[model samples]
Target: MSLHGLEEYLPSLVQFCLSVLRISLPLSLAAIAGFWSERSGTPQVGLEGFLLLGALAGATLVKLTDSMPMGFALTLMIGAAGGMLFYWLACRIAINAILVGLIFNLLIAGIAPFITKLIFGSTGSTPTLDPALRWQFFPYLWAAGILIVSLILFHRTGFGLLVKFAGLKPEVISSAGFSLSTVQMCSLILCGVISTSGGFILSTYLASCYSPMMSAGRGFMALAALIFARWDLPRTFAMAIAFGFFEAAQIYLQSVNSPLPSQFYQALPYLMTLVVLGLRRQGLSEMA
Candidate 1:
């Protein structure tokens, strides 16, 4: 209850919030991407793959073309294409979507290194782009705008209702003369585009080109947020921000020389995930 102590933490809290906001923007968008695909009755487990591909495409293109805008544009297009490919393999070819996504992740992880070696003729990671080509706050602004638009589209629009109907009863939607496959295909493409933006942010803003597995666990984190939010866009955003806050807190804790082990701080988010999932399962059982 001491005002002085509380004031002392205000700056740290604000910095934490800003870091959370940056992290949340990509996560919320990726969750929304998953939301659309799942709401259309197609499970999208390949968001990570799409993200890696997009990041690679954006960074590579920007480096080659020396235009950040061009890189952004290329990233969107390539991401959508990659998504379409996954849909073809999973939905059309009867391959498991999760497996397909995992394959894509491996492929990108390996391909980036191979390409770096081929192009640069060295074992080091891909080189960074010019400073002028880096993406920054603009992508975050765009992500926030997209989140707002996605919320409205998912909740307020006719398309939203159809998507929900498709999710709940795909056969019924099909019986109503709607093409389920088409809806799913569109959803997959959109998911790819959105998830890829996360990659773009990482590559251009955080680093350049894809370093091996640069996506880390963000794709899975986004999936966790989707489940945590129960596919609701607004709730997804809130959960993403909450997760982001923990991530930022870990950094701040390290900076402030917390007595707790660094590994404990690193493990905090995963611990929270386990707790949240357990609670969700319990809630469902009670409802049942």
Candidate 2:
């Protein structure tokens, strides 16, 4: 953070921006994933599941084939499959989407360890990834592309309108001749692929390996961020970046051996998120 050093040292502002990107990119993706699902009127509680599965898939595939592209393709395929499965059960069986999501989250908790054990012959995690082999800037580019695409999709297309209608008024969408299943399916698939990428980013860049519990409730954090932003994409994106900054601060604090309780450093991001959300809610009430 000191700017008085040699020209060799990058400016503090530049370093801060990079750290923020590293921390927030995943959250941005997760928020957008939630946005896509809810924008279509479908409740998404499965983001955590989607994210963990993606991380597992990425780590396993990269380990097997030593190809990041292969890992990404395979992760997307698996995400798509999971999304469709959830859609079928939620749509056909009349189960609440939130319940289905909770089941999937539990499913991830069960299956990630099982797979990790089978592959590594132990529990907790796989082998640590080499820095050169880990994904670096690609996920950032992908996140930006996704945000742009989402903004255009929501504002520029009739299909986007249908997606909105489906969520707010299924009868109206149906009357307009749009199949509710189709809209939900598309959104869920997007949600799966996008949300899972959050895990992918965390594993490949943040940790260098996939662990069963690596995400550590970030998916839920993203959900909370979305709620706080009232589903507005720009605000959601900003809030996610803010959360990322706190996470970055946590990481920095950990390294400095700060006198603060380690527990407080760990809780910093979540605490900040709660405080900001409360403030946002209070401001909204005052405006009313």
Candidate 3:
């Protein structure tokens, strides 16, 4: 490539890397949370619900108390509770976990708007907070730190070994006299807490308080990251960054004069996701 062409692309590439970090941090965390549940052989398709609940709770609580830290703390707690509630329904009531998650997403989607209207006396958006309360990058840093720690815990610790055992052979863990419910419940709570952190990051860093559907399709995207990484934490982290870069590139492309439609540029991330996952699946099947 010509040096001039390379120079032209450098800024776009750098911007893409930053955007990728923003998307990837929460995604990697959510995938790690899902990994824990699935590793224990529990179906956890409800991460989206957990994410929505967390976002709503974080934004709403911050608005109500006018305290950012309290809002974040409560959001994490509520998220854990929400996750545990789903686990109880799935494990104890024998409800399908996927269905339970779907129900929660529907319920939250409806209820959040109503609650926002009730609390803020407005529809579609929440009241704006002070600049300090509105958007903060610290949560992103915290999330990145958590992702690193999770990588260590899952790969290097004895507890990690137990989690692997639980997923691969729940019967074995149960026969060994460990309480499967206990482990599953713990995993669900952890998943909730981490996933909720993403919500807090969104509300606090991107916009203060919740906006309607502010999560957009991030919950599903996070799940996609999980699948793309094959439940591997480090790989998930890297892939999350890759997805972020695609998103950034899409934005950059929209600003430039190209033959492609704007809609095509907008669809790039999801398209890339589908393409990558399809290839990964084919590779696995071929090996099989």
Candidate 4:
């Protein structure tokens, strides 16, 4: 590319970063949800399901009404409630945490399409949202708030301590006279709300519509980020952003002319994910 062409692309590059930020916000939010759930020793892999469920809920409500914000509000409330209910059931049963989560994912995957069929007369998607109702900065503002609230909840409160204890050392929680049920339930509810909020953000800001499997493995990606960050909120946030950048770059590259096969570009994000995680792991090992 000529210098003049490069100069022209600079503006597009800057715009790309902005898009990365927008995409990263929801991933960070979802990773933080994993952090909360894992800290309570109840890691939920069903986060993908919750996100799809929330997206479905938000889209359905918006389709039925003229208010986008109202749909988002109801989505969060119902997501949290559903999460709490799942936690309650898990506590009463003797299922493996991972298995329980997988079950939830399966359930949501089925239900989302079924509901879509009922509402839209198809098993595919909801209508595109009105552009006027969408805010370009909504994801960024919510991302900041999610990080701040997570910091306060995990680092500065007794509830946070109990939640951490539930994961790190259940005996300590018992010794402190804190019931495991309470901590687990709280963690799951928060996880549900935040993760679903991430879903809402993605549906509104990224896709601008809800569709079957719209989450596209983002929840699992968030979980990978959570583990990559060793369950720390701040580091997980950065890692999630990094993953989002990789995803954004994939989209950008796809739009540009290149001899590379489309399949290569499609695989780029996950490839970069492994590369970034490998680098982080190597660096951590060197430091150790």
Q: On residues 91-142, what C-alpha lDDT tens digit does candidate 4 reach at each position?
A: 6474777888899899988888788788888777888888887876767887
**Which residue pairs does candidate 3 place in steric collision?**
20-244, 39-167
Per-residue accuracy of model 3 over 118-166 as CA lDDT, tens digit each: 8778885777667866544676678778887777877898667677777
Computed on alpha carbons, the lDDT of every model, listed in order, comes to 0.74, 0.80, 0.73, 0.81
Reference-based TM-score, model 2? 0.87
lDDT of 2 by residue, 81-177 (tens): 8878888878767698889999999999899889889988879687876677866578889999999999999879987888888777778877877
Q: Candidate 1: where are CA atoms >4 Å away?
A: 1-13, 281-288
Off by over 4 Å in 3: 1-16, 134-136, 262-288
Write candidate 1's Cα lDDT for 149-200 as tens digits.
7778878987777787877777876788888777778778888888887788
Better of 2 and 3 by lDDT: 2
Better of 2 and 3 by TM-score: 2
The lowest-lDDT stretch of 10 consecutive residues in candidate 3 is 279-288
Give the lDDT ranking, best first: 4, 2, 1, 3
In angstroms, the error of model 2 at 213 is 0.5
Looking at model 3, residue 162 earns an lDDT score of 70
